[model samples]
Target chain A: PDPDAAAVQAAMARNGQLTKPPGALGRLEDLAIWMAGWQGTDRPHVDAPQVIVFAGNHGVTARGVSAFPAAVTEQMVLNFRAGGAAINQLARCFGARMDVHALSLELPTADFTIQPAMTEAELLEALQTGWDAVDPASDLLVTGEMGIGNTTSAAALAHAICGGVPADWVGRGTGVDDAGLALKAQVVAEGVALHAQARADGIEALRCLGGRELAAMAGAILRARHLRIPVLLDGFICTAAAASLDAAKPGALDHCLAAHVSAESGHAPLLAHLGKAPILSLGLRLGEGSGAALAIGVIKGAVACHSGMATFAEAGVSEG
Target chain B: PDPDAAAVQAAMARNGQLTKPPGALGRLEDLAIWMAGWQGTDRPHVDAPQVIVFAGNHGVTARGVSAFPAAVTEQMVLNFRAGGAAINQLARCFGARMDVHALSLELPTADFTIQPAMTEAELLEALQTGWDAVDPASDLLVTGEMGIGNTTSAAALAHAICGGVPADWVGRGTGVDDAGLALKAQVVAEGVALHAQARADGIEALRCLGGRELAAMAGAILRARHLRIPVLLDGFICTAAAASLDAAKPGALDHCLAAHVSAESGHAPLLAHLGKAPILSLGLRLGEGSGAALAIGVIKGAVACHSGMATFAEAGVSEG
Candidate 1:
């Protein structure tokens, strides 16, 4: 569903009446208008914001494509549940509830370098699982993922959908050294080349190269769009899933906000393709919705400005 | 005085024990340590944060150096007092108290192109006014400014302290057109040239080329440092004041944080010279401490994570 144009118009009108120079708030004014449009109201509140973290294990860890072992994914899930992770602390600070789901941690996907990551039926099931994770009462939904070697799978999937060289999409995952980074790049290249023809199709590419967690994130984004819940996307991995979802469902991005530009090499181009500008650029590469959680505060401030501040007429202030 | 090294060390050690990857929080970890060191405690809070906006008028506004007229400064002061300005909204959202001071607005400073902006005594008084605005009970101090054609004065000050050409230090202020920007650059060049000998001295440059508000912000920053209250520096105008403070005191930046890289062209080089990295890059150009207000939330989040998160031993999570 498209955003309500009349509500967007109402928001812009209200912004003009605010007792400041025109366009003084810069991107914040745009953020408020976008939120208003999505909420279909001139005054919108960020009610029941949520950060849903989907955890899965990537088979590409077998190729030594990551700095950490695959077992860290399971451990991080436990850390998130214990409210000990960065995302957990961030979610609490921003007044957002965090939900962690270990969808396929015990059953890792097939190694994409050698075979498809998952079957079509498995991909569908992962999507459904992700779709089910969304809270019906959530006004703002943020998607995050925890998976070892997932960046390699995300890179391969990005190479398929974004049609870039694997070297361009691959980056240092979990602070890999020179040799490990080169190994990751090579793995992504080989995987993309292996799934060349099937990758042209979005679902086929997701099945061939994407992880279970990524599949679920894309499903969650689509479902959020269907429910008119504004979605805030995290860094590179989440943007890759968003790109995949956009290819399959053309208007999925209209309901989403790009939270930040990651330090990873692939995020800028993907964000550019989506016609979105990130609210933050902190060189973040952690994937458990930390960037999105930080951006939620900014969004809340924008909403407060839109809804609570007095207009120029009300304040009896002169306009420029 | 320098930050407490022992407190910083304690914070870093605590971060290491947190149940996440080392450096997983990226710059947030650095922010917490910086705050802890400044506060002289392992557990630091952003208690009673305050935003003080100094308002003045520049005679240079008559030369078409800015897109807005000089009257806008006084009008903005009223807007700020009436709680309808961007800074007002942002301050309310971040839980920071907002104070607007109209110093020298009724008596505009002399045009620096032909004469010094203020007398030595006037500059000293302005600095004292800024120093007096500091709230001793507040843990955080944010400096912002409101003055028409102030960017020209800031650019001139930047050129004097940082030694750059007019074009390098000048930018479009308040949405100036190309012609207005060129005029601003020319005005800055002439002003810097007129004060060439005096410009070599830090305090002399501030008196000869800087506005009353800039001088006050510098005093505020220095006072905040003396009181060990961590300062959050706003955009180009505020950063120019910070640059002056650093030059005068040599180590005043130790207590200050750059909030964001403004859309103005001169801000990046000023920030680089201070050896500081901004927390946000939102392309914000609006003054009045809006950028600093936006950044307070990030600082609050960093503190929350530092003080409230569970350690690895406490959470029973395995370290990588």
Candidate 2:
């Protein structure tokens, strides 16, 4: 059975049964129902949606593509662990759990104790780490990343996968100006050219060119899909990891649903390539699963629509 | 004391203090916090949010200005009362109360079996009905309308209040084409000319040309302000009623919050006249408090930002 196909069809059917006009809730209606199908039930509910925020030190941060200093990556990860960031506040609002992991990829030692970057030989161990971290009963997994200038890594990964011009995929990272973006694009183009042979190595290509958290997220998604767990993906950065993972295994996206269509221009194109529909388009550019946490309610709403709505037959109302 | 001004300022201040970047949440940030200040508390929540739907028979509907028949207004109200309409489903989702009123000035009946429409003599009663219907302890009032050619009524009312040319305020209502809109503008212009003398009588101008709900909602807002209740307003039709009330009593809009910036071209000008910011900019042309219901979450989010977020001092984080 094509679980993804069956799941998607089930989602659409749930949306059709909602009390509002068909498609009245727009992208939100689609997302909630899609999540319902992925959970394989009409009464889809998210209890303690966990946000796994993985922070990696990207070699690309050496180049000045982002507004913040590269040191901010580990710093923000600590802030996340301490529950002092925007995403942490959002998680508290949604009553979701937050897990912070520092993946020591480029700089083997950060001030904080870091998880191993995990060499090719240790990939199995890393995968097991991911598996043990997630609850099998989780309704959803939301993976986010913290690495200064990670957008540059994301763009490079997108370039390697799509074979599209790197300049087209690049954008202002963390409120960079036009000139900064131009520099960012030039850096991505050079990085893609530099990493061309590595991308040819598949997952190894990802390890060499992608951020540590992104790769870990890829591993997490693979494990989630294997365990039949569903994932809610955030903006462009997370989408990049999902795309790279999908390239490794053709249907990896089968377990994934998009949370928001970001204002970042690259996000829409990347989501389009992945063939995923985003739930909200509020011009949100914040990372760290902010979109995903907010969207948990929408999925809940969809479940409510399917289960809570008294059908026309039940409400004793004539259907036109 | 300008209660409205104080409320507006408190809202702005509370929003600025929210956890996100100063203006990152955009219009939504403003809406939720504004509501908190209006409610005179930090933890602003909507319990029993009521949507007062006003239905009227418009002469413009007689001129074929709308796609649906004017008879649909009464039919939809009955549908609403029967809990078989789009608004019914939304009200159910939001846990809001729905009240439909038929204006005696435009409807076939004046008895109390259904809601009574008011004449000038019963203005105080109409105002009190709006005030009493809103629960004293409730957090918000959501307003919507259902007159087939209501856009024509809205445009004319808008023209009377703000003095925009009829063409500027006229637009497609329920999929009317360019030609249909042009005809609508001409009809509105004629109506405006015919009612020019009533301009001296602010409420009279509204009564002679406005929809039943428009007048009642005007009374609603005026009463809501005196009662210190907050009103969450819907699209163009409701906005026109709001503008009319604001023009009559300068502080009437103080207790009201615009729920959306509709695709209706007239809405922006009317909003500018009212000097209020709408919470959402979804291109919703439907005027059933649907946009308002969606925006409620945003308001809640803002309130959370104000009441739930720790100050820089409280969080003990460096904010330099």
Candidate 3:
């Protein structure tokens, strides 16, 4: 569904009369107007915001690209279920439901440096799983990922889709030392090179080089856009999914908002390619949708200001 | 009251045991530790965060230094009271109680370009009023202002305290035109020159050129520190108040956290002088304590993560 152009115009007009000087609210004013358009109402309300964490395991963990072993991925999934993860606490704080989908944790993606990460059928199943994860009643959606060593896969995919060198895209995932970072970069370069033909094709790139979690998040974002629900994107791996989705289906980001600029080195370049400006820059690198959950309240405040602030005439205040 | 160093160390120790890699949470980890220190507990909770907006009138409005008239200050106070302002909505979203203090808005401050903005007695009273406004039971406090031309007063105060020329400190308040900005700079320069001696003294400088709201905010910050409650400093004007308090008391900002960097040019310099890095940088210029109110949720999430996340041992996850 297309955003309501008329509602956006109405929001802009109402914002001009909101008792403050013109443009005093800055990016907040833009956010409110965007919400208005997305909701097809002059007064949009943030209701039933949901955060979905897609967890998977990556074969690249064998390459020592991440600080933690691949087994931590399943362990963190159990932790999310036990309500002890950062995303769980943050989701509760925002009154957003938390959904954890362990997408093939028992069967980790193939080591992309040696072979394609997944076959076409496995990639299709993962995408379908993500598409079905969205709740119809959800007014807003935020996507997060929990996969050990997936950053290496994301970096390879980003290098393939976004055309950056592996060194530029690879970062210190989970606080790796300088030597580990160098090894991670080498692994990503080899992975991208091994899948050069598949990298030329968008969907094939996910099958060849991306982890299940990244592919799932890409599917979820596409589904949310199709359902006309706004998606708040978490850090680098999630954004790499969105970047690939944009490659396959352009304009998929019309319903998405960049929650924060991740501390990861490649995230800035990815966001720059997507032409998105994040709401927060707290140097966050946590990836279980924690940044998105933290941002829910800020987005709510923007919607509240759009719907609740009195006009200058109502407040009897002189306009600038 | 000094923050509890033991609690901070304990919080840092627990952070290392979280399921993710060490320092993966970035500044969030620091924020959680700071909260623990400030609250004097290993598990600090942001239970009753409060936002107080101190509204006043600035005499410099008569010189066209601001886009809005001075009367808008009182009107905004009424708007805040009626719960129809941006701060009101943000407070509700964060579950924070909102308070509006109208500080002698009927009698605007004296024109600082010609004479002192307030007498020493008036400045003392304003400071005391702000001190008294802090709720005894509140765990966190956010300070904001609602004066149209107070930015000029704040710029003048910042210039005096931080020792920058008027051109360096003055900015477009409430979307002032280029000509209006030039006039504001000229007015601030003249005001600073007129009170050069008082400018050498911190509190005396506030009396010579600061509006009642800024003095009151300085007072509130000082009182919050004395009471051991963490203060979330708003944009330029509020930061100027914190800067002034720092100069007078030398350690007043020990309990303060910068909420965001405002669009106002003077705010960056002011924050740099105070050795503070803001959490959000949304280019917000609206000052009804909105930025601080918006940040309450982020701070709360950090605290929640610190207290609720599972340790690596608890989750059976191997640390790198």
Candidate 4:
């Protein structure tokens, strides 16, 4: 289903009537109009926003592709539950309902450098877990991931689906050094080389090269679209997951906004490939939906100005 | 007084100890540390952010330099007072204390195309009005403006002090058309040529070409620097006011950050001249400190992540 065109029209009319000059609020006015279409209201408010973080362990950690150990995934998930992580603070600050799902952190995915990252059944279950995680009543959705060495899997997935070389898709994830970056690129090449057929099918690529958390993000994004909930896709891993959906079905990401381009070198090019402009770009790379979670404030400000400002007539201010 | 070096060092050390990898927070980490230095604490928060909107009338409207009538200045000030403007909503959304001051709205400044915009006495009073309006206890300051034909005055000021052509300093302010834009550049050129002596002195340039509201903004920014309150400069007009301060004394704007690059054509080059990279580029052209007010949320998020997140040892998350 498409956005409500009538609501968009009403919002656009109201935006012009507001006290400032037409389009002076810039992208914020556009954001508010976008929210209006998705929420089916001329005056849209994101009263209920959901932030779901899925955690999965990656066997690719064995390749030493990341700076942190795989155990840190479970630890960070615990930190989230304890409300001690950056994501927790940001979500709380922006009034988001945050939930954490640990998808078999004890069961590491098969390393795509050697074999498929997940069996078909495992992939299906992970996607199902993501689909079920979204709250249909929530007006906005933000999906985050917690996994060590998942960036390597994301790089391989992008290489497979986006037709980029392994080097173009690889970057220093979680503060890897020069040697580690080189090794990660080599690993992405090997994964893409072995899973050649995956390049033609996004879902097959997800099964072959993406971890549970990445697949879960794809599922959550897809569900958000069905529920008419606007999605703010996070950095590299989350974007790659969303890219899988776009690759599987072009225009699947029309309801989504790129939250921010991360410090990861691949993120800029990836966002360009998707033709999505990011809301914020502060070089953030901490991928627990931190950037998007922070951007919740930007969205709220946009909506508030669009809805709350007085029209020229109401304010008795003359206009051209 | 300069920012506290000891506090900055302490904050940087604490940042490295946080659960995330070093520098993953990107420019936000820098913002947090900058906040720490200004607040003189290892854990900095903008608890009392003061948003001051100074409104005045510009005689330049006589030159058909603006889309709105001069009466709209007072009307918009009333709009600000009634909480019916975009800046009001943004400040409220970000939990800032917003204040509106109309600096002699009934007495429009002299048109700079014919003569100096203000006498030295009048400019000093306007500057004093701005300097006195800032609350010394406030931790952060954002100065906004509401004046008809003020962008023309700002363009003239930037031209005299920043060594730019009038065309380079003029834009379609308040939604003026191409003819109005040309007229505005001519107005700026005439003002700068007549007051060419102001080219060497920012204060002189401000007196010759800047409106009361712009002088007030300059005064407010200077007072903020003296009080060690970090300032978030708004779009073109506000940046021009800050540029006057920087022109009077090099490095005077070290305590300020460019809040956003506005849709006004002159803003980007003006910011480049000041050597300040804007935080947001949303094409926002609505003054009244709307862009900077919106950025209050970003500063809060940066502070929250820097101050509220648990350290690696506290969260029991492994660090390199």
**Each candidate's interface RMSD:** 2.3, 4.7, 1.2, 0.8
> How high is the lDDT of residue A23 in model 4?
84
Regions of candidate 4 where Cα sits further than 4 Å from its true position:
none
lDDT of 1 at A160: 89
lDDT of 2 by residue, B112-202 (tens): 1112223565554444555555556556777777767778878877887788698889988766778889888887777777778655655
lDDT of 1: 0.87
Descending-lDDT candidate ranking = 4, 3, 1, 2
Q: On a 0 to 1 TM-score scale, where does candidate 3 land against the true structure?
A: 0.98
Q: Candidates' lDDT values, in order?
A: 0.87, 0.66, 0.88, 0.92
Better of 1 and 3 by DockQ: 3
Give one digit per residue, the lDDT tens place, for model 2 in A136-165. 667778877777777777877787787778
- Record all residue pairs in model 4 with backbone atoms less than 3 Å apart, i.e. clashing: none
lDDT of model 1 at residue B217?
93
Report residue A154 deviation for candidate 4 (angstroms): 0.6
- Report the C-alpha lDDT of model 4 over B227-246, residue by residue, as the tens digit: 99999999999999999999
Q: Pick out the ten consecutive residues of candidate 1 chain B with the lowest summed lDDT.
A: B18-27
Docking level for model 4 = high
Write model 3 residue lDDT over A1-320, tens digit each, in one string: 77899999999899988877777777889999998888778887787998999998888888888887788898889999999999999999988988999998999989998889998888988899899999977878999999989888888888998896788898987888899989988998888888899776767888888989988998898888887788898899999988887788778788899999889999999988889999988888989998888989888988888789999889887786
Q: What ranking emerges by DockQ with the best candidate at the front?
A: 4, 3, 1, 2
Pick out the ten consecutive residues of candidate 2 chain B with the lowest summed lDDT. B108-117
TM-score of 4: 0.99
Candidate 3: where is the Cα deviation over 4 Å?
A: none
